[model samples]
Target chain A: MKVVCIGAGNVATHLSQALYKAGFVITQIVSRTEENAKALALSVDADWTTNPDNIEDADIYIYSVSDSALGEMIHRNPRKNGLHVHTAGSMSLSLFEGYKERGGVLYPLQTFSKGKAVNFKDIPLFIEASNADDLNVLRELASGISNKVYEASSAQRQQLHLAAVFACNFTNHLFAIAESILHEADIPFEVLRPLIQETIDKTATLSPREGQTGPAVRKDFNVMNKHLDKLTDHPEWQEIYRLLSQDIINNHRG
Target chain B: MKVVCIGAGNVATHLSQALYKAGFVITQIVSRTEENAKALALSVDADWTTNPDNIEDADIYIYSVSDSALGEMIHRNPRKNGLHVHTAGSMSLSLFEGYKERGGVLYPLQTFSKGKAVNFKDIPLFIEASNADDLNVLRELASGISNKVYEASSAQRQQLHLAAVFACNFTNHLFAIAESILHEADIPFEVLRPLIQETIDKTATLSPREGQTGPAVRKDFNVMNKHLDKLTDHPEWQEIYRLLSQDIINNHRG
Candidate 1:
């Protein structure tokens, strides 16, 4: 199948490469920036275009652009006889209102980073389509690149996105907060890595609620107060500590 | 060296087993409850004692009891010639008051769950002592069990404990929240495993601040508002979402 990737960012780069490796022909790489477009195009052995009007006609047009740019790109690109899909968790299939028959979603539920090599086969892909045929196409395309694929409605995908914010985005912020705290204490962040790894590893065998530990869960007010006192200089961090601790306590309460 | 293990909880069980495997003689297992002490003692091939006074004489006394129990155990147990130490993160070396020459700490910086096997060599061991002699004993003991061992002051260790609360405890709580959100949507939490793993793997190369992503970092008010609206039934979660998102936005703002 021939595919045209509609962005040169991390998601686009990773997904396009995966698709190309899975025997799909990436005909073109289109982006607002010539440099990124050219770079990705060269990597995928595809032609590069800076203008959406120059997008090649292909069997599949994957829009991997940022949420803000998705609408504009959708409007600017010429409608072709192909499947139009987005990789965004938060966006709906209705974004392709005019091209209803071809509109679909092939959202990959994983974070992408530049220079990081991810095995697409291990990543879960969530797909949605307006019709059975388009759904089947998306399913086959997704299955070719990933072993884990599921059909989800737009509302379910939105909820998945929000849960991801808590699981991935917010969790990373907590790690950042830990790093800063260690920084102030002249301790290296490396010391906490094993603990962090063990914490994540426990999730495989136990539910997060059952795996919970530390002062808040134990209701050790003395240690909690001491920690609160230590964070006096950073009131924002103190608020976060207070709020998260209270929530844990509330959730665990009989 | 001969050792008496005071406590039979997760920390005590793991630490005692490690010590036994490392060729240290665990002379006795002491706890307020006979069943727990006997269970741990049976595993390590040591005698068990419910009475603090019955704690056998040894070259080292490893107190792995809870914070509330530590003080009473210290007061009741006869101060032997052995070096005394604790495995608690929030506790201070000064907890061995009046037994000045023997006071020390050997804190393993990792979360311990019952029945889960952990490699002690990978877990960071943080040690502290009131004097040079005790410090050497702790350094030797810690280095014997762990490749990653460091000398940390009481104040620094306290900060490390607090940082861990954010990194491990609070992070796990976020995972629990995500699981609940997915549960509401009839989606399995397994779908998020890859995203969560990637979020952590990124930390090895990038600072958490540099690795931050999602609507919060993007300042995408539209997606953030939609997420908040989806969380209307959960007022506490809404508060957490708002506070954490605001913090991420504030931190990323130039």
Candidate 2:
């Protein structure tokens, strides 16, 4: 199938490359920036265009733009003949109301970094469509790129994205906090890498609740107080520490 | 060298086994409970003792007890002649003040769970000693099991422990939070596994700050408000989400 990607950002770059590798012919790369569009189009062996009016006819137009720009982009590139799908977790299928028969979603439930190359097969792709025919087409296209594909409504995808913010994005911010803590103490962040890795690895064998350890779970107020004292200079972090500890204590309480 | 391990919890169990494998003879397993002491002793082919008075004389004594019990455990096992140390990150080397010449620390910077087998070679072992001779002994003993060994002061080790609480313990709690969120949405936790793994793997290539991506970083209030609405039932989580998102915004503000 001929595919045209609507953005050249992280998600678009990764998704378009994955789709191209999955035997789909990327006909054009339509992005706001000529530089990014040309770079991505060159990599995928497709034509690049910045004007929405210059968008080529394709079997699929995948809108991989940001949440704020998705609606406007859809309105600008109103194509009624092809399948119009978005790659957003929070957006509804109604965004393609003009092409109601072809509107769909192909949200990959994973965080994408600029230079990172993730294995598309392992990512869980959540798909939604307005009708059975479009849903089937999405199922086949999604299964072509990923082994784990699920049909989720827009509501479920939004919840999944929120859960992901906790699991992936917010969790990463915690790592950044840890990095800053270690930096203040002149301790190399490398020392905590193994511990961080083991924390994640434990999830394979035990549930997160079952694998919990450290001062918070033990209700060691002495240690917790000492840690809070250590973070006195950073009140925000202290609050985070206190709140998270209290939550852990509450969750484990009899 | 012969070693006597106090406490039969996760750290003591893992350390004693690692010492035994490294050719150090674990002479006895000492703890308050008879069953746990006996089980660990049997695994390491050592004698088990519940009574402090019956503790064996060994070249080195390693106290792997809780923070609250470490002081009393030191008082109970007063063997001024042998080398004494602890495996606690938050504890001070002064806990062994009675054995001033031989007191030291050998803290492994990692989270240990029951039955989870971690590669000791990769774990960072933080050691501290009052005297040069004892420090050399600790360095030798630590280097035997781990490729990553460093002499960290008591204060430095305490900070490392605090940092670890954020990086490992609290991070796992976030995963638990994510799990609960998915449960409420009727979504399986398995879908987040790949995303979680990728989040960690990104740390190897990009610093946590540079790798960060999400609505909080973008300051997308619309999506953030929508997520907050979704989390209306979870007041504590709502607070957490608000605080973390605010922190991310502040940190990224240019």
Candidate 3:
């Protein structure tokens, strides 16, 4: 299989490497910047081009650009032959509306950062296409790198993206908030490392509901009230505590 | 050093077993119920007793009881000489006020669950004491179990605990929300396992501010508004999404 990765960011960087490692020929690498495109292309032994016109026709075109810029990318590329796929969670695969019939989603369900090594085998791939043949092709492509792949629809992927906000993005925000609090108190955040790892590890064996602990789950009004009182000055933290505690209470009740 | 562990709950169970494994002589395991005491005592090859009076004087008396019942525990087990400590984050070492000479905090900064094998060496221990000598003794005891020991004050520990509620407890709630949303969509939550792991793995390499990726962080108001609109009925999820996005935005602005 041949692929033309249409961005030089984290997702593109990692996915291109994984595909290339899996023996898929990356025919070309395109990015807004010549340096980034050249760097990744050199690494993967593919042709590098900053101009969209230089993008070659291939079996697959992965538009792994920023979500906001995806529509603009589609407009610029204007490819009508091969399959055009976007590696975005929230963006609809239909973004490539005027393109070829092979347009679909090749979304790798993991948070990727530039230069960080990602084990594609452990990451899940959500594959969706317009037809059965395209779907099977995408599935084969996804299955080459990952053990877990699902034929999720655009609506389902959108809902999954909304949940991803809560699961991955928002959860990290919570960690940042906690880090900020500890920073202000002149406390090292390292003390909470074990607790964080254990909390994540518990989900491996038991459901988060069953493993839930703390004042909210225990319904210790005294501790809850104490924590609320402390967060009075920080309304954001207070709002978070209230909303999450209410969720915990509602979860337990149900 | 000789140690007497009070309460046979998760912390007590794991702590006693670890101490025994580390070649420390655990003289006794005390609990409100004989069965609970015996269960942990047998693991450590120590004697068990339900009565507080049966707690023989050791080099250290570690109370691993729930926060609410701490005061009564201290009152019941009056120690004349050895360093007495409690493993609670919010609670102060002053809870052992009557025994001013040898009172401290030996907080194992981790969430412990019964039936889970916890490697004590990996868990950080936050220690605090009323006096210098007692601090050293408590520090020594802590060092035996974990290389990561910090002499944190009562105020520092309280802040750390509050931070933990956001980092660990509330983060788990986010996972619960994700699980619920996936369940509603008839999508297997296991598909998100890799993404979840990557979310955590990203933190190890970069500051969460540096690692932040999503529609919210990018201020892609279109996707954000779409998600909010989708979550109109699920007010709880909407509130979380709003609050966390705002926090992320505020943090990233610098």
Q: Tens digit of lDDT per residue, candidate 1, span B1-254? A: 88999999999999999988988889899988888998999999999999988878888999999998888888788855789898888988888887535788998989988988999999999999878888998899888889999999999999999999999999999999999999999998889998988888899998898999888998988899999999999999999999999999989989
Residue-by-residue lDDT tens digits, candidate 3, B5-73: 998988788888888888999999999988898888888988888988767988888888888887888
Question: Is candidate 2 or 3 superior in TM-score?
Answer: 2
Q: What is the Cα-based lDDT of residue A190 in candidate 3?
A: 63
Clashing pairs in 2: none
Candidate 3 chain B lowest-lDDT run of ten: B93-102
> A1-254 in candidate 3: lDDT tens per residue?
78999999888999999999998999999999989999999999999888888778888898888887888887788567888889888888777776556688988888888878889898888889888898998989998888888888888888898888888989888888887888988876666777888888888877887778787887877778878887788888898898899889889995
Q: Where does candidate 2 stray beyond 4 Å?
A: A98-100
Q: Given candidate 1, what's the lDDT at residue B11?
A: 96
Per-residue error (Å), model 2, residue A237: 0.4
TM-score of chain B of each: 0.98, 0.98, 0.92
DockQ of predictions, in order shown: 0.84, 0.87, 0.67
Q: Report the CAPRI category for model 2.
A: high
